[model samples]
Target: MSPAFSVLMPVYAGDDPSHLEAALRSVVDQSVRPDEIVIVEDGPLTDALSDVLDSYERAQGDHFSRYRLRENVGIGNALRVGVRRCEHELVARMDADDISVPDRFERQLAVFERRPDVDVVGGYIAEFDDDPDDCFACRIVPTNHTSIAARARFRNPMNHITVMARRRAILEAGNYRDFLGMEDYDLWVRMLSNEATFANVPSVLAKARIDRDYGQRGGLSVTKAEVRLQRSFYRSGFIDAPILLYNLLTRASVRLLPKRIRGRLITRYTRTPG
Candidate 1:
């Protein structure tokens, strides 16, 4: 028998309405559908975004649950609230602008069934522009526990939106905290520190939207967050003092670069032809 899971997503007013629609459709049309989808409106949304949510709720009926916050809370707090509302022990994270492949959930579930020791599993993502059919690059990550743990020392080892995690483990690791752009990374570090195991499916299981503004998303503030996270890892003995210093200097330098240059560098190194 297949295990049931809840898909958790947070939508905000700033999201492109079309992208939100596509994201919702991807999940709803999955080969192994979610038992429930818990979507939290992080604050008041634009009429269009609200309409998109309304359409999905109407179509999905009881399978879809919606929660609205009185005011805007960041993704960290928003997700923390959403996770608490999930009925299933397994929770999958979805971004408002990304599209999960039809078999994504099924593949992730298979990993859980075969490896009970893995508390979290994510997969590669194909990055696209305005059209989903035109994928430009794929972001791949390490696939085993040891490799993932080592990678987490210097960078985020998994794609945030592509992850399916154990609800108990997530809550036990302190749930999500307000970390701005580094919220997912923060939770991952905490989970690793708590001895939660991680893995990634080698295939691209989702399509991530990337545009000119991608580079601007990680600025000085994000760099500060990374430095803070790296320090936490060092203090927790996840990495040594020398490794921490190396990470701090390199990450900070990258973040301080011009957005265009940073974007080019990221594209050049983190991406490969889809």
Candidate 2:
């Protein structure tokens, strides 16, 4: 039998109620469903979202759990709390708006079963706008440790929402910390620094939601955060001076482009590499 696991999801006011419902359904109805679903309400939610939670609570009963924060904390902080509260040794991360394929959990767990040395496992994601059936792009990452670590030098090597990690490993690596947009990347770098084993199943495990504006790079604050993250990468020894300078220049130049052109460039960079 598969070991028991928990799914940790963080949702805030910005998440759509309908999308939340779909995400929950995907978890409970998975081909190999998790024994526990831990949802962290990042802040007080809208009545619509609360109502959706109410319905699920009634239907899911003991299998479902909710923890609400008095105020808004970012995903990293919300996950830090939920990770500790989880009862199982294996924890899967999911986004409030994305939909998982039915066998996602089963496939990922199989990786752990086969390779007990792996501390974390992730998979590819297909990006969809209004309809999942019409995924226009996919983000593919390396499937083995050497390639994954090498990819980390320049980019995020795993899709955050499709990750399943050993609870002990995550905690030992200092749990999660708040970062503007690169929290998972930050955590991965620390895990790498600690010599944690990693792998990815070679498949699209989830259909991630996206919008027209998803590709648009943010303003000054976002760029600053990117620069800050690259610096963190440098200090962590994931990248050196030259890689850092190249990343900053390419990122800053792209952010200065017209919105449409920037969006196109970002989307292209996000797709499966040639």
Candidate 3:
């Protein structure tokens, strides 16, 4: 029998209701369905978003549930709280604006079956502007534990929106914490330190929504967050002084470039055409 898993997703004010509906529909139409889906309302949502959730809940009946937070917490904290309420050992993370591929869960589960020592299984994700079917680029990562660990020092080794991880492994690694844009990166680093084994399916697991203006989003605050993240990595011994300085100079400086330049740089190096 396949292992039971729960899909954990969090949504807030900024999420698009239409995108959320599409996201839900993608999972619902999966080749292998989840036992349940636990949605976290990070804060009060617009009536439109609430209505979308309501429809899914009504349609899914007992298979769907939601937990509302009294106020807005960052995605990391919201997920930290929400993951605790999941009723299964394996939990897959989802984002309201992303659509999972139909066989995503089945593929990840197959990895776990073949590699029982793996604590986390993730795969590549496609980045699309308007339609999931027409992806422009893909974010691919290393497939084995060794390469994943080595690459984690320079960049995120797994797609946060496409991972199926063991709840026990996550809790042991300290769960998700608030780190602005660095939450998933931080957690993965900690999990690596905890000696958790990981693998990737080497195929698209989900399609993440991106805007044409993706490069224009970062600013001074983004640079500050990058600095803070590097410092944490240093303090945790994830990186040494030399590697830390290298990142501050190379990665942090990239963040301060003109929006067009930054976007071009990211698109040139980080993405592959789908």
Clashes of 1: 0
**Superior candidate under TM-score, 2 versus 3:** 3
For every model shown, what is its TM-score relative to the native structure?
0.96, 0.95, 0.97
Candidate topping TM-score = 3
What ranges in model 3 sit over 4 Å off? none
RMSD of every candidate to native, in Å, equals: 1.3, 1.8, 1.1
lDDT score for candidate 3 against the true structure: 0.92
Instruction: For candidate 3, write residues 136-230 as lDDT tens digits.
Output: 88889999999999999988899999999999999999999988777988899999999999898889999999865486346789888889989
- The residue-by-residue lDDT of candidate 1 on 1-274, one tens digit each, is 8899999999998999999999999998998999999999999999999999999999989999999999999999999999999999999999999999999999999999999999999999998878888998888999999999889888889999899999999999999999877889889989998999999999989999997336635677877877777877888788898888898887767888888888888887777887
Q: How far is candidate 1 from the true structure (C-alpha RMSD, Å)?
A: 1.3
Clash list (residue pairs), candidate 2: none
Which model, 1 or 3, shows the larger TM-score?
3
| Deviation (Å) of 188 in candidate 1 | 1.1
The superposed Cα distance between candidate 1 and the true structure at residue 129, in angstroms, equals: 1.0
- The better-scoring model by TM-score among 1 and 2 is 1
**Decoy 1 TM-score against native:** 0.96
